[model samples]
Target: MQGLARGIVVLGVMLAGVQAAHAQPIKSPQDQACRDEARARVFSTPDPQGVGPYVIGRQIYMACMQRASHRASVPHRRAAKRVKRAKRAKHR
Candidate 1:
């Protein structure tokens, strides 16, 4: 009886977690591109047997996202130029 009750509680918690969790929509076109590429790369290969393909695809997606984040974090060229000019000129 106790085991069954614990199982029921675990099931309820799992369901609640799944219901509460949501995907963070990617805002940039670059992220969308990464997702599209990941999907294509993952789905292009036929794996009718095991979960290897899905796992590999997830790794690829993570790597792509890492790259996208790096690229997005870089400041614009105009902003960089302004900073350089400011650094060169010291106000009295």
Candidate 2:
């Protein structure tokens, strides 16, 4: 009885492996060449440089603001609320 159960389990595992193997077919030579060509084209272009000092400075300020916002504490949040209230009060 034990041997029969082991055999059934082994047969089930073998069938599952066969199904998985058939699910993905091997790529043909033409398909492989097309994939390689696509990869080469995607990586061929070089990145462009920044234009001038003003643009570079603005980018740096934005990056600093983004980092500061991400690392801000509860105190910073309260200060931001106060600033917004002050701006609204000036408009009124």
Candidate 3:
């Protein structure tokens, strides 16, 4: 029916919006501080033998961002890990 199709589309749009919202990394003040310190440390260090400073800086920045985001998601990560382990054990 037309009404049922419209309801499905509306539900899909709402779910997509929720997914997009959760996909964004929620950075805390501590995470920002950690990333800033990482940037400073990276800049202070000399570049590797063949790599350019810019490339090195980019890599450091990416790593710092990952670390900071992971720290921010610690609770979520722990819950996921626990769920995974439980599921795995149940199958065995």
Candidate 4:
């Protein structure tokens, strides 16, 4: 009876955990490229976590991502920067 009860509890916990487990797919080409670059850089560099010198793959990835993000927002920034002039010739 105790063994059966434990099995039921484990099954219940696993079922509950299914909802929380999820994977986010890469959303853009820039993101995919960044990931590829990071993977390659990390592999080529010495593994600090394993041996010695730290890898700068993460830095490469982040810089690329930030640049891409900034480029994507440029249009919106330009729009926000310009305000339309209002004419009051009628009042004059």
Which candidate comes out best when scored by lDDT? 1
Cα-based lDDT for every prediction:
0.80, 0.60, 0.74, 0.71
> What lDDT does candidate 2 reach at residue 39?
43
Clashing pairs in 4: none
Using all chains and alpha carbons, the TM-scores for the candidates as numbered come to: 0.44, 0.27, 0.37, 0.38
Across residues 37-87, which tens digit of lDDT does each residue of candidate 2 receive?
Answer: 444443343425736543454454445455555665336677789999999
Candidates 2 and 3, the one with greater TM-score = 3
Q: What is the lDDT of residue 32 in candidate 3?
A: 64
Off by over 4 Å in 2: 25-92
Tens digit per residue, CA lDDT, model 4, 1-92 = 99999999999999878755632478889989887877777667666556432237667778889988988877765454443212344345
> Cα deviation in Å at residue 53, candidate 4?
7.6
Clashes of each: 0, 0, 0, 0
Worst 10 residues of 2 by lDDT: 38-47
Shift in Å, residue 10, candidate 4: 21
Give the alpha carbon lDDT tens digit for every residue of 5-80 in model 1: 9999999999988777744578888778877887789967666666787576776778898988887898789998
Q: Which stretches of candidate 4 lie over 4 Å from their true place?
A: 1-24, 43-55, 76-92
Alpha-carbon deviation at 69 in model 2, angstroms: 49
Model 3 residue 46 distance off true place after TM-score fit, in angstroms = 4.0
TM-score of 1: 0.44
